[model samples]
Target: MSEGRHEDESQTRPSGISTDVEVGAAHAIQPPRLENGEKRTDTEADGQNDQVELGSSGRNTTQEKPYSVFSTNEKRIIILAGSLAGFFSPLTSSIYFPALGTIAKALHVSNSDVNLTVTTYLILQGLAPMVIAGFADNMGRRPAYMLCFTIYICANLGLGLQNSYAALLGLRCLQSAGSSGTIALANGLVGDTITSEQRGAYIAFASLGGLLGPTLSPIIGGLISQNLEWHWLFWFLLIFSGVFTVPLFLFLPETCRKIVGDGSIPPPPLNTSLTDVIRHKRRAKRGLVFDAAEQAELRKNYRFRFPNPLATLWILFDPASLVILVATGLNLACFYAISTGASAAFRDEYGFNDIQIGLVFIPIGVGGILAAFTTGKLVDWNYQRHAQRLGITVVKGVRQDLTDFPIETARIQVALPILLANGVFVIAYGWTVGHKISLAGPIIFLFFLGYCSIASYQVMNVLMTDLWPGQAAAATAANNFIRCELGAAASAAIGPMSKAFGQGWAYTFWALIYMAFAPALLIISRRGIQMRSAKKAREDKRSARRKEKMNRKG
Candidate 1:
């Protein structure tokens, strides 16, 4: 049956009709229409069609394959690898917390000088992704991953051996530049392989490493710093990242849709994995070959382009994107204030040792873990509920036309309540810790704060992917840019702010600031569709103009 369908697809491809039509022939499904009522162009629909012809095989029959050509297990493995890569970014930051005082003393510098390293690490964290994300979106995820890991591994080595404050500050920025793009790339991987309907859950799962890093790192950092010296932290990061990088390079297949197109087309030799290379040899022996013409067709108009940091800034300036980013960035600023201040506050107020301070972070981490499990499923359920309410049929493994769908409402409805709850916890955490309440009192609030913060992050992460689609990495880079800048400021200011204002009022200020941004969510929910429509119309006009010029040249 598959062979017969393949033959039919081949015959139909020679004619002017799109391969999407052939794939949909079984179900009599029409091509999706744009907001303006025009059918999707052949180029737009080709991705779907390629999945049917090229992805249909022993395990992934054309009828059964999801929007991504990769199987369920394959997707899980890829996301896991991406998540591990993301893990190192936050781990690098948080692991240094327990050693901050030690490092300052060893280097004979003020504590504020050590804190400056943290601040600079974050600033680079925001800016570096802009440089890498455009490359990831245009080139491929694997190569970008390779580039980041290589830079990260080298920076860690330098950081481990460095003795001076100057060396520490410079290497930390280098480390930040190396590690930060992993989160953006991980988010991009989700966009590459998952559809919007199923994206909420997958995004949460992919984010587990990042969300858990802050939760878990302090404990590990405390253990290492308490037993050994501050330098071992970087040594640990170097070894750990090296272990993950080697396997990822060998096993993880490229998932960039532009480069591989739903995992159907073969990636360039550089992007191909060792496992994929082995599999390709076996397939060739079985008389399955990707002929020259097919390969050329896939490569047409796709060329290597220079990475543009400005592309990230461009997305930042978009009306809808700006609102979403600012709101999310404000939330991140609040989170940073809490996490960054916790070590100092706990040490000073509660008179906790490094190990005890590290242990106190457990509740927050626990909360983030719980949020990852619960919020993801909740968001998915919300998506389905909204689809049902709109009378839109959502087919598994098929991309839905979101042209008229209330996606903003579906995502934000789940987030708004979570954000409000988060604000409450932020205030509670501040007051409990400020009054020198029982350790348990603040610990409990920390958990809820962590839960609410990460849950809100998951929702926005998924929403950003939905909003930008193919440019998920760039969108996330912009998100990182805004939030990290705010976070850097918050990290630097939180100490002074806490010193000036009491802890209770300090967090209350952050809570109020967070709440101020809540209206941005409501605004986007109400007006996002109109903004998207306007943006799409403008994009379509530009596309039309380019095509007309190309035709005249021809």
Candidate 2:
């Protein structure tokens, strides 16, 4: 067997224990052999004292500190900040739903022309993350977040003041560019702090704010547009975002593993928050400084690179990733079709006013909120069940080597049923609207639609993060790219489709499209590992060639 294959086998051995090297340690101590005469590496040893001696405040004092050194409480706080940041993306989009008609009237444009704003927003939403996510992965999450908020705040200011249709269209794109990257950045934060075993619940919690946006925004928008002018909507977002951005700027620390490395290494001044500076000062007062040599080494390893938008597209070249992105994108497009059509449909069919239209969205939004909490727990439970069945010992706060694990099965199994139910809900929701049935029929279907759609979306989110360990943001950005593009297309087409085929058939067509992608999930569950292994082999070969070229130059 090849030496690399031997190492892989040793790492994945069922009886092996997981461990980590002490941060700042010069070298890891060799581990003893197992009963089967297999030697363990430092990462496979049992009960090694791998503590990093920084201070009581920012050190990993235990051997089982997982892939990250941040405590559970710290991880929650970080994810919470990221979640709040992510909230603005969907909030900004959905809040505008109620104001679309009002804006169309004010700007002296056709409703179709106003709808172009939504399409452009989604286009930027897909494209902006391709740049920002790469920058976050390379630089730090804090800086990238600050950049997003600054741009968003400015765009909202312009949007609130602008009167012309041309200005409205341009500024909404700016608004999208500012808000869209937060979802991707939030996913990256989860990957930095949480282990895979705990990631499902953590990601779900992190997603709560974003999920709440669709649920709450329209009601808020309705109130704003009804009581005040449509311009007040942008002003409200500006003030709210500014208030939230202050706390984030003051408290949120840099959690990027590349820069901080499990919270032990101090980040550069550019990446450090005010709270980080204060913590370092306190640690310094006690004569506890981080090892200068280790800090220098981390800096050397994390050389700055310009954000490469093309890199996001490169993820699509992998068949496994492509399948996941396309399938999930189609699901999102179905959602867009429902959401984009709801306002007009309710206004026309049920004779509901703006407030009532917003109120009707409550069911779908509530469904998403419930799904976030429930589906997250289900995903985690399924992971643990898989671990037990595979005979792999899962240690809390320690990263599990999933090379031999059926992670696809663990995640997708939770989503497959949900996807099927979502299709049913879509069909039901369409016919209910088409028949001009009671409000309750569409409302009830909307609830289930939101529940199943979000549940399936959560599963895909967790799976994508797992597939790309360090590059969670980029993976999520790729997901956002595909989904948002499809959503834009769906939003543009839904009105025409509904007008031509009637609501019942229009949604039935969408339901069928969503179901068509269902088999792709099964393909992933069965062959994903083989595809991943092959991709890894190709990556390893390229790495070897690069080393050989550098050696020849030397």
Candidate 3:
């Protein structure tokens, strides 16, 4: 057998609790056989004292360390990490908005050329995350985040210094490439750390960033762009990004499936070769033992190359994922319709400046904040209500029986209101703007739209996360990919539509789209139980095959 294959066999056992490792540990003085054909020296033994302690007390000792798996404090920290990561995408997009007019003037470029920068940025922002999401699942969260953010930070620096539009577009793609990882990995990280019951609140926070970053960013960017040069806008982002990253590096523990040793769940295996393990052993003999889990983790399992992106594409086009795609797409179309419309519409009707335009986003912010803050309590309440209604109770956090309170119920409840509200407001805002209606009329309708949009958005996000329990990040990434792409298209196309068919007719068309998405929500809600049953049946068949294989081996 090849040496590399031998090492893979040796390391691929559960928890490194193999008979050989344990037998080696039983001996006190003799050096164990190193994979390199060298004996472990005394120096190495001294350094691995903590790992040796694993055998003490018959392997039953537990320490009440301030941080341990699944602790309450650690959960909060994980949420914060996920939230910080989610904030980067929207921050990058919105931060540039208030500076667009200035960039056009400074570069002596046409307004359309400057707007292309925005369009280009949005396009990449939609595309890059899907690629990054693929890597993150295979490589684990930490490597992906570190690599992506480094590019992001450098892109901002280049944006501050570069004068050419060509350079700016290239750098913006890099920035978007980096920022894209934030949303996918944030969802992945939450999956890494949180259980399904606790997932609702964490998902709520992750979804909240879609609203939070846009809300705060425009306000901050407006102030900077109005007073300082547009270059300072990037400087502010550079500084802000550092503030979050520094703390993350210091305190954010690695929660990747590879790093955290367990066998119940599967992750893409390590990418190390046998020679690498031998080299590590030699280094360990020189008084440099890698931390226990790290050494074994890298040695275990075969290295995975990138999976076919077609699998995700297949999943995206699947009936289940498609429902989410369309629901979220409408949500996106409606959301960007308001956000994009805000600048030209409000400026034309209410005569608001960039700062005032930024301020008007506060209603969306307020609406999102209220929905997210209460979603946890609301989700839990619904969970309990469904449990009681269905005559079931949870024991030690696991439900013995699932109640009628399916995740889709939340989708239906939220979607209906958002659809109706968004549809009405689109028509109202268009008509009110078409004719000279009261300035307050459009704004009032928008505020209600904000509340409804966010509530629906939250429900869809949480439902997607629930449906694909193990692969929530991939699912959410797919959702984001569809939503942003559609939203960007709508933002560019809406103006043309409004001009071609008049504002009233254009909005009536949008209302028709919103109304169409509503039935998708209802269908998911109605068919959820049957779909879940089908999924369970397939899993049972897989389990039976695995058992038959084991029986044959035995």
Candidate 4:
């Protein structure tokens, strides 16, 4: 998806809420529009003027609303929905692990073959996000979420009954497809609803599910599998997912800019809506009314472009973003490595049963809970303190005069405890595990490891959203894609990697990698102000040029 193309277009009033399709452009990208009832160009307006202007492109360019106007109720709904949605995918992923053995035995497949099912699901989960955001960005949050839940339901049903290995593999992939959308949409919705100051806290809460789901899944799965048939796992997920979807359908208002006006930009103006316009044109051209949802042609446009699975590669390549990505990836990799390796390691070293294995995961869960609840308050305090130190207003008020706000201070501030805790605990955990130390040694380290990992994950998550507010979903999807890919690779290779290098030595290497993220954090902490100011300057200039172009077009 080009940064210049608006995600949506509607034809009705001359002005509604026109969102800049520009993701991180130095110029104002025009929203996709209709010209004489046909699709027009996607180029953005050039940045050469000093006032707000409309472009030949149909989008209305205007100032952005201050983030403070989001009502308490609105904020709660968005956060809760996002978090719940985000939680489902991870919940399903781990919940199925304990059942894998049973599934293999029932399907009459080799364990290794069954393991491929897990690997395939993981791959699909990582890949689904790159494309789903484009749909949510264009269609509306409600529809995208509906589709995700629909997929989730259907797959869970199949998963419960499937007897063949091929059938299981197919259904699992579909399940992952549904799971992918939850976190992807959650990040984007939070971006829509919260301010930079409060965003960390919001993300921290939403991320609870991602951390908790995995931590608790094995335990929950083990309990269910031990007492009942393994199929009950899917049955339970089906019921819970269905219940969650009902309220979500009823209360989850569209948070996409195209659906709800943010009070700054005017909506697109045309005589026909995006759907009607596209449908009519297609009928005129092909002598048939094309179905937008199943229209093979239209859907192709929404598919993930290959060769760049990480949609944020450009963003990641930027020296600043690269640093962030590496640090965040390290944070993710370390935790996943520990968690992934834990089950096998525990069974071999401590002779733990499935139930006992689940119990051992409690330290990680508790640590995550503490960090998640605590980080919210800490983030708010940090934001307020920064505001006071900088002599900026410390109240919930609009910034009516500025083209953009400084977001880097908030971004870098998160790195403080995130990098520190993550690095220290990882090394400690590794050292203890490597030495085959006492259970308390490993358990104590798990506590701190969970704390630092979740804390860092929350911080890195919010920072990514802050860096590119409009593209939060895609940005997060990109984060998910990258970190998950790295984590998956680590999972696939760690057994050999650890074996080649002693467990202690292997972890020591991982610890070194975790610590390496510190320099990146330091750079961002030190130079974040300059980078943010530069970004703001460019945005201001683009907004000015957009204003100039609009005047000329009018």
Output the number of the TM-score-best candidate: 2
Whole-model lDDT per candidate: 0.75, 0.76, 0.60, 0.62
Task: Score candidate 4 by lDDT.
Answer: 0.62
Cα deviation at 186, candidate 4, in Å, is: 1.1
Please write out the lDDT profile of model 2 over residues 191-248, one tens digit for every residue.
7777566776675678888788889999998889878989999999999999999989
Q: What is the TM-score of each candidate against the true structure?
A: 0.87, 0.88, 0.75, 0.74
lDDT of 2 at 503: 95
lDDT of 4 at 421: 65
- Total clashes in model 4, counting residue pairs 3 or more apart in sequence or in different chains: 11
- Candidate 1: where is the Cα deviation over 4 Å? 1-66, 281-294, 301-304, 547-554
RMSD (Cα, Å) for all candidates, in order, is 7.0, 7.2, 11.1, 11.1
Q: What is candidate 3's lDDT per residue for 210-251, written digit by digit as tens?
A: 677777988987788878888888888888887777766544
lDDT of 4 by residue, 158-266 (tens): 9888767788789989999988877888887876655455554565557767777867887998788778887789888898999888877765655565443331121
Better of 1 and 3 by lDDT: 1
Which consecutive 10 residues in model 2 have the weakest lDDT in total?
20-29
Segments in model 2 whose C-alpha atoms lie over 4 Å from true places: 1-62, 281-291, 301-304
